[model samples]
Target chain A: MVLGGLIGLAGCALFPLLWMLSVSLMPPGAADTLPPPLLPQHPTLANYRVLFAQDGMGRYVFNSLLVASVTTLVSLGLNLGAGYAFAKLHFVGRERLFQLLVGALVLPAQVTMMPLFLLLKWMGLVNTYVGVMAPMLVTVFGIFIVRQYARSLPDELLEAARIDGAGEGWIFLRVVVPLIKPIMVTLAVFTFLASWNDFMWPLIILTGQEHYTLPVALAALSREHAQDTGTMMAGALVTTLPVLVLFLVLQRHYIQGLLLGSVKG
Target chain B: MRPQRLTGWLFAGPALAVMTVFFFIPVLGGLALSLTDFDPYALADWHNLRFVGLGNYLVLLERPAFWSALGNTLYFVVAGVPLTMGLALAAALLLNHRLARWQGAFRTALFAPVVTTVVAAAVVWRYLFNTRAGMINVALQAVGLQPVDWLGNPRWAMPTLILFAAWKNFGYDMVLFLAGLQAIDPFLYEAARLDGASAPRRFWHITLPMLAPTTLIVGLLTVAGYFQLFAEPYVITEGGPLQSTVSVLYLMYDDGFKWWHLGMASAIAFLLFALIYAVSFMLLRLARKRGAA
Candidate 1:
């Protein structure tokens, strides 16, 4: 009984996605059916082909890939340095500043959106890739995660490095970077997935179709081609397949980071 | 430890600088922006700007759209949070059950939606809930039930969104509940079983209490997350079908970007922040009273 119930819930969770996959592969008019066939009668890649070649979806996919990857790499660098300093380095106003940051987390990111848009406009970045990528290049949560992990690193190693004539930059690159490699990977994945999935800010910023990320493009497609279920599903599939694959491959780091975040900051 | 002020500043400078210039200053600027009549004219040329003080906030209170947006947002929170939490608790309990097999697979399947791109998933959901040729309508016909326009009808729109939001989010909370369930001692259940307590009785008395802290945290997180509903409505309904699914954040996006009403949009943003902050504070206080860590 328990097993049956569990499977039922899991099936419900997965049914929509499975159905989407089935319909995406179906011939053009196949999904408009009586019983809604469980499997495509003749599976074809025509929808995907049309999406990439005709609809210019490949550009959106490339945009999403570029933005997410750049945001992840840059965020990893910024957060690692700041978080390590908060954890291991002693400085004036360290505790106070960290406390201020933790408090600021309560203020929703929306509070900054309107003015940040103006700020980006003044810097002549509005409607550009740089505008969409600017504010997200460093995240408070990323810094917090790195700081939480970095606190566990022993100071003795850093002191010994200093005694060996290693500067702060050299020690960070050689010592700290290797030690916190796991969290760095985790943070990278987190930032990448988030930027890929992000909608609102990108929607607000990217005014032109040429600059639209995959999510923004999919949203536009859904509105314009509301009748084209097959193509919409294909678009959705391409957009989601990458992150889903990454999650499956690095399942441990993702879930570990999730639990660690929930249990701690 | 000796203070390394110079090195610490050097290490933290770039991030702190970015945060200050982009995040902190803009947050303060949003508040300042809210106090002015910074419309599209102001955007075009700086000569149109005017310090309106509380006029924007006052104007929002008078506006019917703002109230409707707030109502829709509250409806989502009041409706969506409990539904999602209930599903999460049930799923967590089922996965934690002693008889459950292939637990990891089940957990992964259930949690997959949380990781998927929202816009992509929302597209799939839009297809499934389509009015005419939708799979849902076909299934309804199979069951001899009438079809309803899930997204096109204003009444059903929010509820359909609530259902989709719950499905997308419950897995995340389920994981949290699973962690809480694991932390509970088996000996407690052993004791209850020995004391002639029925399974339901044990669950009601023991499981619920043991899960209270997790429940509080989950509830807070869910409420906070749900109150900011935008993308689902944007992609699915476009806040359409008579503006039924217009959330506060959605309204802010429309006002700030679509219409270029920066002052009014900033006001809406701060109002939302205040509401979330207040509710979070209350939840934290309640958790403290319950000795929740």
Candidate 2:
């Protein structure tokens, strides 16, 4: 009975994703046929081919990859430096400053949408990749994560390095950077997936089709082609598959980071 | 700890500066903007901006669209939260069973949706829930049920979004619950079994109490997350079928970005922030009191 229950539970959890895969492979109009077929009678890559060639989805895919990767690299640099400082270095008003940053998290990102849009527009950043990447360039959550992980590093190591007359920059690069590689990788993965999956800000900022991220592109596609189930499924598959793969590979760190953020907050 | 003050400042300076310039400034500006009649005209020329004080808020309170948005948001939270938590708890319990095999694979598969881009997944769900050619209706027909227009009907639209929300989110809570369940002592279950407790009884008495903290956190997170319903409604329903899915954020999006009613949009944003703050505070307090009791 217990085994049967477990099997049923697993089945329930996996059904949608499995169904998505099955339906994506089905020939046009097959999936929505009466008594929806579990397996495609005629599998075809026509949907995917059309998505790539006719729909210009491949461009959007490249845009998503570019935006997500750039955001990750840039933010990682900013967060790592700042996180290390908060954790290891002594600074003026450090506790109070950190508290203020944490407090800002309560102010939902949406609160800033109106003004930030105007701000970006004024800066001529709107509809540019930089515009999509700007607000996400340095996140408080990323700083907090890096700080939390950095705090565990031994003070003696840094102290010893400093004693050897190494400058702050040198210490950061030669000592700190190499030491925190794991957390850095973890933070990089976290930032990349988030930027990749982000829909709202990108949707708002990237008004032009040329700059549209996958989520925004997919959303537009869904709106325009509501009847084209197979094609939309193909779009969804394209948008989702990359991040899904990343999560599957780095789930441990992702879950750990999630819990850290949640519990700490 | 030497030169700690300067070093800390140096470390935190870049992030703090970025956040302050981009995040803090805009939020404060948002509040200030809410007090003004900042419209599309203001977007073009600063002279067109008029200081309206509480006029925007007053107007919003009397607006039918605002009320509808609030009602839709409430419907989403009230209906979506419990359904998500319940499903998550059920999944967690099933995974916690000793007889469960292939647990890792099952967990990953379940969580796959959570990691998927919301807009993308929402797109897929839109197709799946489509009226004529949707696989959902086809399956319903096979099961001897009449096909319901999932997204087109005002009555069924919000519920469909709620169902989608539950499916998309429950896996997250399931993981949290699984962690919480693993932390529970097995000896308590053994004790319950020895005392002639049935599985359900054991679950009710021992499982629930020990899992209280987890449940509280999950509930709080779910409520907060659900309150910010935008992308799902945007992609799946477009807050459509008689505006049944018009969430507060969606309303703000429409007002601020689409219509260029910057001042009114800012007001809606602040109002949402206030509501979320109040609700989460009350929830945390209630949880603490329950724990004390």
DockQ of each: 0.79, 0.68
Is model 1 an incorrect, acceptable, medium or high docking prediction? Answer: medium
On residues A56-135, what C-alpha lDDT tens digit does candidate 1 reach at each position?
99899889999999988888999999999999888889899999888787788888999999999899888888888887
The window of 10 residues in a row where model 2 chain B has the poorest summed lDDT is B1-10
**How does model 2 score on DockQ?**
0.68
Task: Give, for candidate 2 chain A, the lowest lDDT window spanning 10 residues.
Answer: A5-14
Candidate 1, after superposition: displacement of residue B85 in Å?
A: 0.7
lDDT of 2 by residue, A45-103 (tens): 87888888888988999999999999999899889988888888876677888888888
Over 4 Å off, model 1: B1-3, B290-293
- Kindly give the stretch of ten consecutive residues in candidate 1 chain B with the minimal lDDT sum: B1-10
Off by over 4 Å in 2: A28-37, B1-4
Please give the lDDT score at residue B86 for candidate 2.
95
lDDT of 1: 0.89
Question: lDDT at B32 for candidate 1?
Answer: 98
Pairs in clash, predicted candidate 1: none
Best by lDDT: 1
